[model samples]
Target: MTEFDILVVGEANPDLLLRGDVRPRFGQEEQLLTAADLVLGGSAAITAVGCATLGLRTALLAAVGDDFFGALVRDQLTTAGVRLMPYAAGGVPTGVTVILSEPDDRAMLTLPGTIAALRPQDVTDALIQSTRHVHVSALYLQPGLAGGLAEVFKRARSLGRTTSLDTNWDPSGAWASLDDILAHTDVFLPNAAELSAVTGAANPDTAAAQLVALGTTVVMKDGARGARAWWPDGEAAAPGRPVDVVDTTGAGDSFNAGFLAGRLGGHDLPESLRWATVAGSLSTRAAGGTAAQATRADLMP
Candidate 1:
């Protein structure tokens, strides 16, 4: 057995969430009608925390500056039982995200900060060889790291470790190197829009097929509608579990964590999806991104 169940590679940051009725215009300001909170975020933060909460022996490889935000991030990860490796330079500032959410929707403004410093050298071979699953996240934003990251995944595959990817955001939608990354990805998780953007597919089925053609197992997430997985064996659809949603920020991460947890525990694809949907639904009941993330007790089966 591997020493760690999952190793997440990405960026870590602090997030400021303003909840309730308050809107900020381009040139105008607004008054707060609700409350605000400071919490941990970034793709790696949410995914690693979710994995740990789901009873996985999780390890995180991310860059964090030598500033206040970085300190807080380290402390929070430590409290969450995530093993962290040093990856940032001294004196740099950690990344941050400012989120404004109303009763029905939310918008965000993110500063990459030290997150931009994350490079391929930060992903050590020992770490890759030690984990059962190695997940690479937020590829689009770190174009510089993408190529090298691909090499790491390729090496991990050669070592027999399962590889997964979460292409979190693609603001530009240009995937000049996406195929290279997918070639080494055993599992590829992308939201509907991101799938369309990456595969240029008019619909979900085509997009999923396109990803599988690139040699990856596709897990396509469609908000509200549900999620599906496609591989050489064909496709399996998993309906979304209904819930009283409070926030949707960490839903996807929680879903991934739950799915991986189920897989590690020898569950079938459908069973994994069921656990994933439940975990995602549970994550919406709190304030921050991972606020409602479920533990082993919350995810029975």
Candidate 2:
């Protein structure tokens, strides 16, 4: 039997959220922010935490600098019950994102730092062999991992491990190279915008169909509208749960965690979609990605 239920391979960073009504004028004048705080901020890390919270045996394999921010990241993940196999990069600073939050939406300024330095070798064969599922996230942030991700997923499949990918908004806008990875991905989780962007399709249905043609199950997430899943056999959708909105950071990752937990536990697609929607909505109830995450008991229908 595998030692871990899920292995998350991706970035780890701390988010510095600045909540306020005022915008910076950029003239070097002092602008006071209403509130500021640091919280867990990487897509992969958030998903790993969510999975562990839902009672999955989860591990995170990523890179972080041996610095203050890195320490914070480790503490948060460890507290959330996620085993860490993190590389400590010397000299490089730990990655950090500055999120300027408004009432409706937010903008982020990110420093790549150690997040961009993750390599393929970090995901060893031994790791893949010991996990029942593998999840890859933040494709564009880590060029080294992105280059060899296809082979990684293929090898995982060969070892009888299912795989999932969440290529969170590519900053470079070059979404053409993910087809190879999708060939080995069992679950492809993308937001409606990401689905459209990656496939160049005008609609979510077309985007999902294109991914389905690539031999992967496609789950298109639409915030507030819930999620839709397309498999070879059939397609299903779940309506979004109503919730008072806060920060939407890592909501998609939380959804991925919920869906994967249900799938690994033998739940059907529609049931998994329901859990996913619940998780996503609940995540937005707090100011940070992980604060309002639901536990397994809380998610029980």
Candidate 3:
């Protein structure tokens, strides 16, 4: 039997979230207000942590530099119950993200570092065969991984493993190199803005249809509206769970974990979507991505 339930491949970094009066003023003045937290970050890392918390045997395969931040990342992943299979980075610097957080929205400044350095060649055959499902995130940042992920997913499918992709946000707005990737991907997870950006559709509904036509299941996170899925066999959606928002960081990644965990546990599309909605909403209860991530009991009880 395959050992791991999910293999999350992509970025690893720490996020420093500063909340309350975080608007930057550039007059050489020091200002601070409410809260600041340095916590585990990166979409793939957060998703892996969420999956592990949701009762999946999860692993993270990504590069983290041999530095203090890298050690921190390792500690965070291990503590979260996700196995860390670190890539040999030749002592590069670990990546970090600084976020100015608000209830409704947030702004992030990231140092790409090892976050953008993960490559497809690093996804070994052993890793693919050992996992029932493979999930990749932050394709926009991992430019090296982006170009070659289709083949990696293709190989996973041949081994009877399912694959999913969440190309966080393309910073340059180019949105290149997805047609082939989606062809090999079983599930394509994107937020409404990401969906529209990736497919150039007038709206997320049209974007989902466009991607579904390409033979991949489309799970589009609709922010406050919740999540919707379109597959070859069916379509389903769930409305957002009501909650007082905290930080939206990593909420989508948490949603990815919930949906994947539900599907791997044999839940139907609608129920899985609902699971994803609840997970995502609950994640916002804390400052960072993985802090308030949901467990099965949290979702059920």
lDDT of 1 by residue, 115-215 (tens): 77777877777888889989877887666678687788888888899899997877565666588888899888888887888888878888788778888
How well does candidate 2 score on lDDT at residue 11?
85
lDDT of each structure? Answer: 0.82, 0.90, 0.91
Model 3: per-residue lDDT, tens digit, 56-133? 999999889989999999999999898998578887799999999888888999999888787788998999999999
CA deviation > 4 Å runs, candidate 3: none
Worst 10 residues of 1 by lDDT: 24-33
**Cα shift from native, residue 172, model 3 (Å):** 1.2
Cα lDDT, model 3, residue 133: 96
Note the residue pairs that clash in candidate 2: none
Return the TM-score for each candidate structure.
0.95, 0.97, 0.97
Give the poorly placed runs of model 2, Cα more than 4 Å off. Answer: none
Higher lDDT: candidate 1 or 3?
A: 3
- Model 2: ten consecutive residues of lowest lDDT: 20-29
How are the candidates ranked when ordered by TM-score, highest leading? 3, 2, 1
Any runs in candidate 1 off by more than 4 Å, and if so which?
Answer: 26-28
- Estimate the lDDT of model 2: 0.90
Error of 1 at 28 (Å): 4.5
Better of 2 and 3 by lDDT: 3
How much is 62 displaced in model 3, in angstroms? 1.2
